[model samples]
Target: MRKLIFALAPVIAMGGITLAVAQNATTATREVYVKARPTDVLSSNLIGLNVHNNAKENVGEIKDLIVSSSGQLSGFIVSVGGFLGIGERYVVVAPSALKVTYSENDKKWSATMDTTKDALKAAPEFKYEGRWSK
Candidate 1:
């Protein structure tokens, strides 16, 4: 019985180590986001969402996004002007230009830009093409 217990001790320790290693591996690839209070949002949910400035001025809405082949977000196409998007035009801005945050007080997601509506309207139009990435 002593010999059997000694042999089983090594196997039990090995099994415990294996279980710990498997748990670590599973967590390594997992993405963690705070539930219900997230300041982050998926791009699909952000499309056509209203954007405002710091002073709570309505600016424009996000129209489209440009993504790199390496899966990096390159630019955002913001549509400005028009009523209810009737005559809205598209302008390109770097992804860094917009700040996305959830307002705890407002209980909503907000997108803010440094520039104003008029300036955004004056920005050069961005036309999407297959060769734009090239």
Candidate 2:
């Protein structure tokens, strides 16, 4: 009886360990935060974003990202048109249209529509009106 009990003890311990590991694996994933500088964060992965207007014309490139006081990504400030920044227009794009992706080869972000520069320029600029769009 003693020998049999000793043999069973190891098996029982292994079973309990397996059960604990399985339970942990099923738990929901948690978000992790990493420390980064403000200037570095904005400059990273934002410089080459291709900007298109409502008419689907490629307007320009992303100049910088604007963050709100609450530490949330507000919008993208893009430089459009003009030679040597003479006639360039800085437009703020909503975050909804932006898409960030990473593939085997190229890693970049883009807007999902063939929006034209003129249309983007004409779209209702972001405002702080109390009512939200329906």
Candidate 3:
């Protein structure tokens, strides 16, 4: 009926306006083009990389990376004291604690930490439960 159409007109117009605004906002914020710089290392490359201490002793391996809601690197999850996925403990290390480097000639990437294997094992463990569980 005409009365019904009149009642819904404002709502429909508001929806259309809201949709247009959302589209424009998305376009403005979205990255349409991106390039990988030489200094940047992919997360896929870092994950599973073995971490060693200053003396080159095996400490742990990077299992996962924690990212904040604001798209910031929060922590690196390292698995320590594990043999073939058996008795490993997971610990969240600070982003600055692990040093990552790339070698062009060797075509390899390496990660190093200042702590030892026993130190990492003694640190607080992070269980992949609750929100972190698959």
Candidate 4:
């Protein structure tokens, strides 16, 4: 029994030290507390927002957001060429191609693309293959 205890002494001490370190990590105060935005913009809120062209014309509404497996933004699906949601096509666009800005007077975030409505409508449409989601 004494021989067994001696052999386990170093292992027991190492485990205790590891537990203490883990406890210290959890109890330590956070040094960084930065906020993402002054106003909390929910992902749900952005889903159906109006999408506009650079010409200030109401082109379409945001259909969906495409994200990669790594959680990076892949693109946006803008519903174009639709009259009240009819005859509309969902087009995928590069995220960097659009400009998103907050309007202080309106108290809302607006999205704008440099391309025209007709141009976006002519682009390739987005279709789900049942394997991936928007």
For lDDT, the strongest prediction is 3
Predicted candidate 1 versus true structure: per-residue lDDT over 29-129, tens digit per residue: 53232243232345665687788887789888988766544334567788899886578888987777787666679866667888899999899987656
Model 3 is weakest, by summed lDDT over 10 consecutive residues, at 6-15
Model 3 TM-score on a 0 to 1 scale: 0.78
The models' CA-based lDDT, in order, is: 0.61, 0.47, 0.70, 0.60
lDDT of 3 by residue, 1-134 (tens): 11111111111111011101111112434433345445566678878999999999989999998865534566889999868999999999987788888789999988888998888989999999999995
Model 3 alpha-carbon drift over 4 Å, by segment: 1-25
Question: What are the per-residue Cα lDDT tens digits for candidate 2 across 106-134?
Answer: 54444434566666667555432365221
Tens-digit per-residue lDDT, 1-134, candidate 4: 11111111111111011101111111244222234444344456568878787688987777777655434456777888867767888898877776666678987778787788888878998876677553
Judge candidate 3 at residue 67 and give its lDDT.
66
Q: What lDDT would candidate 3 get against the real structure?
A: 0.70
Q: Give per-model TM-scores.
A: 0.62, 0.50, 0.78, 0.66
lDDT of 2 at 125: 53
Cα error of candidate 1 at position 19, Å? 30
At residue 131, give the lDDT of candidate 3.
98
For model 4, state the Cα shift of residue 130 in Å: 2.0
lDDT of 1 at 54: 75
Runs of candidate 2 exceeding 4 Å displacement: 1-42, 52-57, 107-114, 123-134
**Which candidate leads in TM-score?**
3
